[model samples]
Target: MFNRLRCGSGLIQETVPRFGFGPGQENLFVHKFTFSTSKRLDRDKSLIYNSQNKPLPRLDPSVVGTGNRKRAQPVIQPSEKFNYSVRKALELIYYEEESRIPTLFPAGLKLSRYLKSRTLPLEIDLVSRAVLYNTRQSKLEKIHLQRWAPVDFDKNCAFSYLVARTPAEYAVLVTIFREISRLEPNFKPRTLFDHGSGLCTGYWAANTVFGKLTEMFCVDPSTDMNDLATNIIQQGVQNVPLPKGINFRLKAPKTISLKYDLCLSAYTLMEVKGSLERLDIVHSLWERLEEGGCMVLVEQGTNAGFQIISEARDFLLRLCEADERDGIVDNEKKGEVLAPCPHNHPCPRYHHDTVPCNFSVKYSLFDIPYFSTEDVHNDLFSYIVIKKGRREGFRFPRLVEEPLKTKNNFYCRLCTGSGMLQEVMCNKKHKDLFHLSKFLHWGDEMPVHLEYTDGKEKPRPVIDRSERSMSSGEHFRDSKKEKDFKEEKDSKEEKDSKEEKDSKEEKDSIVKNGI
Candidate 1:
């Protein structure tokens, strides 16, 4: 109660309005609030959508066991705040059947309203399970379904909104952060914009990424969904307030009125239905990005998801050419593929059903207490990031396959700009390169030079002594240094608390000895 300042109605206007513009600042920290009174029909059902850009922290070399095999684990962990929401979801749908009252949010005034508006149907439990399965399977098979409004809004909001949808978005945002951080380690976003801001999953993800956001805006179309999102988002704010400045709107903006550091269209493009309309909306959102800003789009890791990402990728490539001819921009700044593709070339795996242009990253799976089996999750997803400016980096390509040992050398499948899909080998004679190749992973970029065109043979890409590969080594060293610093700090703190530790030990001895 003390942490949050309630402002659902006219509370903001009545407050002291401590919002201020810092010295020598014009547009910095400008806080404004406006509500759209206009309503809409045909918005019964709510499908909320959800970002982040943090590079995955380097793995400790010591983590590998004596056998030299390293176990890859999810680099991200859900915050305690997020876990609290998950637990709340568990109570709502499951415990509600037993007539259990929610104990977490004591401010049940709004929640009770939703509960009293209608009875929780007997079929809610079954329906929630069926709906979850349908959504999960739809993603796997690339099947599209038109969402009809839920009969029981509470159950839907609990299972679909808080449990399933929010968590899925969080996973995508985690990977986005990791990949983005790897691309630009110093990326500190001032503003984050979420399209289809269902429940502000992107907001939560942004916290796990940048840890600081100056301002954030979320827009959704469904009133029911918006209400639920607002309620939950506000509740989340009670514990952990992220992005110091935050706002949520009920309606979508007609156009991009303000530029953003990061713009996300996660699992949202599919809602547009029409390819052209989706592309047009994506283009508009892209335009809203400030120069050097990043735009990330996440879709279900199905064939349809792959296709939509492919179309968006091609659209980005042609944007510069079209702009040059139509005079859309003065210099025609080209968009660059930030991740999932080493270069902006046609996806060779486009038609390959078995191997589509996608990468699967795993996240920690969450299970509800009693219904763990039914709520089992697969954290796999397909996503792509496109940058507004040139993606200046390497010339070779990225490995889509894990490096494996052959009869004499190490080899992997690489997705290259000119070479397309090709097998690259690291000869054993090149001991340095070979040893480095051993560490080459499925999502890592390959450093060797290879042919862009299959028609001719090109010289092997040369890796100089001061090549970019050393960045991984540098990251390892930096991580080690940080670990050492933390250990030293912890040791000093422990030594300083020696008296307290001895006192605790003495008390423990007395208790154990039954004194």
Candidate 2:
């Protein structure tokens, strides 16, 4: 969604310059542009028109999509702390090495001699061919879907997951490794906790740029990803010496108390949905890091984070537009007021301040070269690095168990013990009735409502709940009681019926012989 504000006749455009390219270079004039809340740019004021010295009609930024379109504006800014750290590191490398060199990692098990025998061409060819035959879009494609090859147990394809890895992903990982290596030269990261380490492409990137870290903790819940990571680490990897005493823990929860030297999380946090859980994850990472440890986060700028900020802004703008057009305030409009400062320290945006989540998200990015000579651009991904602050001093305001109740949000008529109506019914009475029927739509399945002790009805017995796992003792007791009850009832009924039948037969025989 895009927010279009009505400016007087013309719109304001912000132009940002590209760095590290010569004027003659086609990539030199990379445009870092973003759409304004106002109208289209003044045709006369825009740089392209000025450079060409030609009169052009007014154009809206919305019309420009790709190639010949204006670029997105930079939303993030690099702070002094971040800028200084990057600059000092670059200076140190220049003074010490006299040239930029990629950082090396600990040798686990060197398979270079074996890797040379297998060229990159061979690996890529195999990956492409296999993917062609196994892709979801291909009608003829068929997947064996076997973790282990049937023909040979020992022979495994390390490139299985890499076959599906995307180009954007590859680019992001490479960029991260390059930047981290530039920052810390001798920082041979011993413990790598790769959260959501999808496929082995990340491991491949790590191996290529940083060599073999002492022990790579490839953390991912996907069985396919885990298999691929294991295969890549154990198979014919070049120059990466597998650590003899290294530990590999997969799928299960990690209980090791050891802190990581460098933690790399790419495309991890964007998947976090719940606000509370997201904050917890960040805090957990902070706690896991050793003092002065480095954490590098790379996400799809196009898909996540501030990328969604645009959508949120557009939503608010539309809400306002609807209200103005209708001349009546919609219920939603009341909550659409923007915070005074979107990026305030301990920001109120997304309720970060009150939540246990803590991170100084700095907005910054570099101008990357596009394939065309005329176009230089910013890749949406921004790199964020935070050094763990003093643990004792880093106390956030105590997390309120629940958000403060206010009058404006307090009167939620729909949820006020009323089932989508004007009348208030005991929610407890309705809850059980609702649970008994499968006809009601509750998302993809019937809604399960447990009896609430204080709800409109008395709490149900503990055993009535379906979720309670029956213990062995309870199971035996239940079966024994049921069997005994059945046996006693059957015996009593059988005895009474038999006695009545005997008396009737005796009376019938005497009557027949009376004649």
Candidate 3:
């Protein structure tokens, strides 16, 4: 005995007892049901069986997706920050004078050329060997000893730097600080230590990223530079008071009484006369960093700049290891690399590749006199962030290059946690991973797990340059293939023209014959 229940455009056949039953008696016996639909249901509709004919829960529209797959989200890249302080400083100093505007262009060019040609001072021991080898003379020349001259940051030089370099420096610092903020949302620094703080760019950038700070200690050796920075802080026009808890000094304090939550050294190490002095400065900065604080170091994107950053990274790591071994520092408080690297092992790029690992940020150019030819420019920089704590357990692979999106798959060159550079591919077959790959950018961490074997790492495969171009969504053809294509196209055009001419001639003949 069966009963037919009417549903929307469907029939449900249910098994029940032959006798009429009351509401409570319906559940006394076991019942079986089969449902059939005359037409297909819409995607938004769902059919559910209910013996009591009660109302059902509504579905959430937001959770619905195409084929139930997760939707792809947009990737967040480094953003440009409008430097109001720099703009105000420039306007107050130059006063929009037409005469002063034209002079800025030449000064900027001269400053750019000088900074690019600058190099570290040569060692005294190397000076003697080089003189003997080059001049073939027994005695070293005094000229060789006097070759290295330190840069003098006079008023003119300071003005030139503020015009040519401040915007780029601010942009780089902002990018680094934003990265730290994004990765560690709870990081709020109470005090900042800006080493070699030229024009106090670090303070401005930090303020932009982390709001107000309790104290900022800035140290620089140039009195003119310090004065310029102070003037900029005061905005020159209205004699605005300096920000609270901000201090400037011509040299660092001798005692280590104060520890800061954030320490920054940007484009400063390269100015040191020797490597030993740079190391000493790095160690001192590390000492001043409070426990669990972060230390940031940034340099130019050149190979020399990369070398400087790497040296600092290695020296700090070695120092931490030595301290732990000597029972001076606990394992829990050891310093670790925080960004642009996924592992504490030696950098693969430093040991294996000739090219340096660097990233670029596009920043808006200041509206200075004669300097606004391009509205935006790219600032290439190398930076390393070190935090004083044990390394986190979960680490992600960093994309070393811009991801390539082909028609079939996405390719990414990654620096894995295993200390190897690998090229990985993601396709539609990998549902979630493919969706995630679409949002990846260079210098971003990939949220995927990788397994490693216990043996030696494998070598990277040698890929042809042409193939790489094609993989990057570029259509490239060999010379022979291009020549053949051209020939075929020409022949087809010739044949079509000849046939048109023949048809016209035949029609003319027919008209002449009067057929």
Candidate 4:
């Protein structure tokens, strides 16, 4: 069915990661590979394999060799022209049952045959053309799709070519934007610079929410993707219900000298030329922002600040340990013990688990528009706003007591204890979990209390008990229950402490006695 391009595929099947070079560029190619699970073969099934070695059924001519019976090629290249063979292939797949379509190659051949006379070297070119057309026609429906805007949607094209490729980045961008919007309304930015704008998703997002004349600049190193992105943006601008005023420029970062009000880098920093080189690039881009300008960065967000590190770890754990390369494993004697990826894929000799991680570390080091002025160690994807210079005094926004019931449980972020909460309680009871300033100082409303840590000389004042609001409760029964709970917790702590102390003493005695 996928052979026909008439079969409709869901986001799960359609969203494979495809890679390509620029148009008209030599070595330009796109690869589509799908990965799915298969049930174990029933070796005991007597009919499945004859002990005497019976030959399998002959290949169906309609399925395999019929494509050789090519009709007359149209004058125009099927891929070059907007209509004709590509459309036919698309209709074929879009109309078929999801289960009937077996592989993308069949659908690819149908269009490739129509365009084979065009002399294009790669079959992927036709596929790319076909999928690009599909994306333009398909509307993203999920909130993550809407939020990530152009980038996630753009990567959705990759779905046809890649395995385990799911672009959920849009949700992150939208969450940050929505939070910032709700936090500071008057701080609407007028100009934005996206450092590594793969497919210009941020531009679409900005256009979707702000709708003002926000000058947008998209930068990327890949010439072909940049071209595709440029086309996508143009297409979006021409058709998308955009706000009345908006200007867009797709150019290299080095060329753009105009200072912007905001800058964003989504999944681009990790793919930069090098580490120090990427740092320089970020600095150069940062300089092109006016005072009070902010920068937003998004990436894979891993432990080591480099992309290769995370990729290596993921490969070792996922592919090496599993000993399964899907279908892309290289079987010929290449001196390597195991095929790195699935059988015939075009990635390096490794299993790719994620985009790189450079966007996380270096971006956090620099000062941007406004947020924290201290050293930041972000674990997962982080939201940062760096301001240029000191401005007028400002009042902090009131902390919203976020209700646990309202938050999505899909994502849970991590950080070392030194960074923030050690084991942050994101449970429904802790609604205001992220409001850092709430527990800062003891005040009139809060009671002064003393708490002690082990190996300390004296007890420390963790909280002032007198300032606690529940201290003045009029109901004796409720107050008694509260006091009893506290006492029970204290008793448990004492018992644990005694056990620890006794264990330590016993160890010391044993050592002294030379056990």
Question: Relative to the true structure, how large is the alpha-carbon lDDT of every model?
Answer: 0.58, 0.37, 0.70, 0.35
What value of lDDT does candidate 2 attain over all alpha carbons? 0.37
Sorting all predicted structures by lDDT, with the top scorer first, yields: 3, 1, 2, 4
Question: What local lDDT score does residue 140 receive in model 3, on the 0 to 100 scale?
Answer: 48
Candidates sorted on TM-score, descending = 3, 1, 4, 2
Looking at model 1, residue 105 earns an lDDT score of 26
Clashes of each: 9, 11, 0, 51
* lDDT tens readout by residue for model 4, 106-169: 5433432222111112223443554554454434322112111122223223322111111124
Please report the candidate that would top lDDT against the real structure: 3
Q: Write the per-residue lDDT of candidate 1 for residues 141-256, one digit (tens) a residue.
A: 32223221133334444334454345556777887777788677767787988887766778778877788677888876666665555545544334444335787776557777
Q: CA lDDT of 427 in candidate 2?
A: 29
What is the Cα-based lDDT of residue 32 in candidate 2?
A: 29
Which run of 10 residues does model 4 get worst, by summed lDDT? 441-450
The estimated TM-scores of all candidates read 0.58, 0.32, 0.68, 0.36
Reference-based lDDT, residue 92, model 1? 50
Which tens-of-lDDT digit does each residue in 295-361 have in candidate 3? Answer: 9999877666777898899999999999999999998999999888888899876664445688876
The most accurate candidate by TM-score is 3
Winner on TM-score (1 vs 3): 3
